[model samples]
Target: MKKIVLAIDSFKGSLTSQEAEQAAAEGILQVYPACEILQIPIADGGEGLLDTLLPYLQGHSISLYAHNPLMELIETCYGIASDGQTAIIEMATISGLPLIPPSKRNPFEATSFGTGELIKDALDKGCRNFIIGLGGSATNDAGLGMLQALGYRFFNKQGEELGLGGKIMKEVASIDTKSIHPALEEAFFTIVCDVINPFCGPKGAAYVYAPQKGADEAMVKELDAGMASLASVIRKTTDRDIAVCPGAGAAGGMAGAFLAFTNCLLKSGIHLVLEMLSFSRRIKNADLIITGEGRIDRQSAMGKVPYGVLTKAQEQDIPVIAIAGSIEEVNYLNQAGFQAVFSITPAPLSLQEAMEPIVARQNIRGLVSQICRVIEINPRVISSSPSHSKFSSFKKR
Candidate 1:
């Protein structure tokens, strides 16, 4: 009716956050041509995080040649703020699983060396404030390869310097941080993560994620053992027991590596993104807030984008609506604080047909338009009560 805020996440394979918000805005405008709509692109610190935060941070993309998961050179890019003091790096762009073909997706052979190279470059460029998104990584080396690129060397019992890949983890008996980049002392890192798996155990990185990165059952066990070995060495080297920390296993134990060797803070992906976006202030006066992702289910109530948006809106007593391509546990979502949950698919269609960008945009727009029509017919439909003062004040305005 008045001011509406759109803070939606990417629809995975269908639409980006910006596209989804644009489609929703179109729908709202269809019913109320003069209504004010604010679009805020959002992500859960995964693939689209750099793009989502670039404009807001006044940053530009910087491209460079870096090693992929297989240690082959590839062109990748990260974001740097205009002031040159802050840099944003998404690990997925440099060493993600998607960069390697499924047949070649070997966690044992993969490396996060490229991610370290990006950080080293940023440090060289005079950046000391870093925001690193650790998601979709292809390696399970516990950040050994990344640390190697940053001048942290790993040596075996025979004083042999080990090379990259997860298989080398077990051979690492000693670490040398003396050659580390001089600029590291001034750097402060913020790691964006969502999972809470520990460094080494059944619920740890190797057991929980290595299989997805192309490790077999035997490889998983070996990788887990390697992580445990590395953790023991890290404890001796850094005097910090980072093995069982929550989220230590995220990005294949990359979070654990940072925790042990760097001045960094780990934050929930959605919460970090929302804080960076000033989400609470943005939605303070919104009459309605719309947020969703590709699917809404049990995970949606976890630290996902919709959950983050709902929390902020609820704090201000603003009504929130969520729309998804598909949804489950509708009753649970309603009980979780979403004023209403909607599925954008107007009719039954094949998954392939429904995922087409054009079709998704149309579905989103159509769904939002109808929702706006309902509100136009009866504003109280969205408001908590007919006598709600916010709606009363909005009508006077």
Candidate 2:
């Protein structure tokens, strides 16, 4: 019996990492009943992290009445591990783009206070190590609200306290951290980040990413100015120019805030997830390793999950195949060590239609089945033409 390892990420809106693995396992076992299947559900430290990692830690979620950017009441979720030593927080869960309607999109009015509330809740539960996912955020407050929730104070020029969200940043004249949470000094904070955007510049959070969250030119300008204002205040008060730090722009300046206040270290989200899941151990000694995401393209070769897995598998000389919802630049993917590439779409269909949950699962099963069938007949067929022909000629010689 051959051994196969399935290490896959969540298919976003379609299948979870575990569900995807089981779907592939069921399909593979139907054809190759004797095959050994290893299921490793992986996450890139984003939205589906709870779905992928909670099971590993025996973690459960708790909801809190947190404040949104507009100071509106919203119930947000954060996870706590069974051991009560670690907590998982996805910033998007508290200050996500979806929480505010498109018509209400205003980076100036969004706040990270809800995320701060999650952290506070975790602290109350005696969890000292926090792994925070800093992606898909909807604010540019430079973490002012978060700091406030953690016992810092923000004041305006008139010595009056500022309000929540970036709109009030323009009025921020000073920050006082004398009463910060005592446990924060003892906490281990790891920020899972995807981009390396600096805090304030032409390519900064407000300038480059705010527009995507419905910030207009005016709102972008406002956020940019507000971030600059906050940066100056923090520099004067804390002697740290966090605005220029790498990855400081992540999650609408939440990264910078964490760095400055909570003493968090930023890391590649995929790398962190892989380490947590022991992905390298699973890839070792596998005849074949399969991994994929929602889409595969030039971007996949970057720090995405597929790229991360391929890099590790290549170290062991293990062959890998990618099954994506859609594929572009197949040649580029070939260079990334994908023995073969597959698209889950069965026919001509819109991306939305193809990404339908049930359809994606079935299509993934079908693709995995076909790949297994081909591999069974000729294991060498997984190689590309140049390599396959070279090996074939060697065999003949």
Candidate 3:
């Protein structure tokens, strides 16, 4: 039986990585039941990483009490690996865009403090190696609130402790590390981030990303000013100009805050996921590999999951096929080593309609079925076919 490795990202808002893999697996089985199938759910270190890592770590989910940007208590979830030696903290669970109400959306008011609380909880659970995701955040507070929760203290001019939130950062007069958790100093943190935006100014988190979180023109200006103020304080205290630091703008400047406050290392999220999944070792023996994301475009070639997977597959001289929600600038993926690319949508459907759980499953199943049919007729097409050569031939014709 031929060994096939099926790796795919969660179809955002449609299906989880496990469900997507099952749907594709069902399709492949229909065509070749005798073949061996392996499922590897993927994430680019953003929204779906928790699901992706759960299978590897033998982890389980737990609900924790957390405060939103407004300090309103809410129920949130994080994961602890089976070994109890690691933890997975998805920032979106505590400070995502969806948690805030539309009218109340305010980047300056949002805080990563709840995220800090989640981390503290994990640390208390005996988790010392942290894999923190740095995407889908709704704050620009520079992680001061998170630091505060970890025993660092943020104070105003009067030496009064500031409440947890971005708005409070503007009044900060000092930061005290004397109370920082002892466990934190011994811990190793890996921040999975693909963004490299600076902390302040036009290109910084607040100025560049506040509008998307419901900040208006005026709010953007105010948040930017607040971020600038926070940066000055950080520069004065840490002797590190975190405001100009690359990736400081990620997750609304949470990246900058984590770096300044902790001994965390920033890394390409997709690359880190690939390493944790051990995709390199698997690619060595696979006959053909498949990978995809919610969308495959020119950007997917730039260190995204599909690009990471395909790059490694290329090293093994294996071929790759991509299946995505929609195809945009698909020709771009060819250069990334994809032998073929397929879009999940069968007919014209609105984005919302396509995203319906059942509809997405059906679409992906059908797409995989179509691919299986072609593969049955010419299994070597993906295994040995010259992708760019075919394009060149077509151009010549």
Residue by residue across 231-322, what tens digits does model 3's lDDT show?
A: 89888988878878888888888888877777889999888888888888866666567778788898788767788888887777777899
From the highest TM-score down, the ranking of the candidates is 1, 2, 3
Across 337-373, the per-residue lDDT of candidate 1 in tens digits comes to: 8889999999999999999999999999999999988
lDDT of 2 by residue, 243-270 (tens): 7888899888888888877767899988
The CA root-mean-square deviation of candidate 3, after full C-alpha superposition on the true structure, stands at 4.0
> How well does candidate 1 score on lDDT at residue 58?
96
- Model 3, global lDDT: 0.81
Query: TM-score for model 3?
Result: 0.89
- State the number of backbone clashes in model 1: 0
Candidate 1 wrongly placed segments (more than 4 Å):
383-397
Please name the candidate that would achieve the greatest lDDT relative to the true structure: 1
TM-score of every prediction relative to native? 0.93, 0.89, 0.89
- TM-score quality measure for candidate 1: 0.93
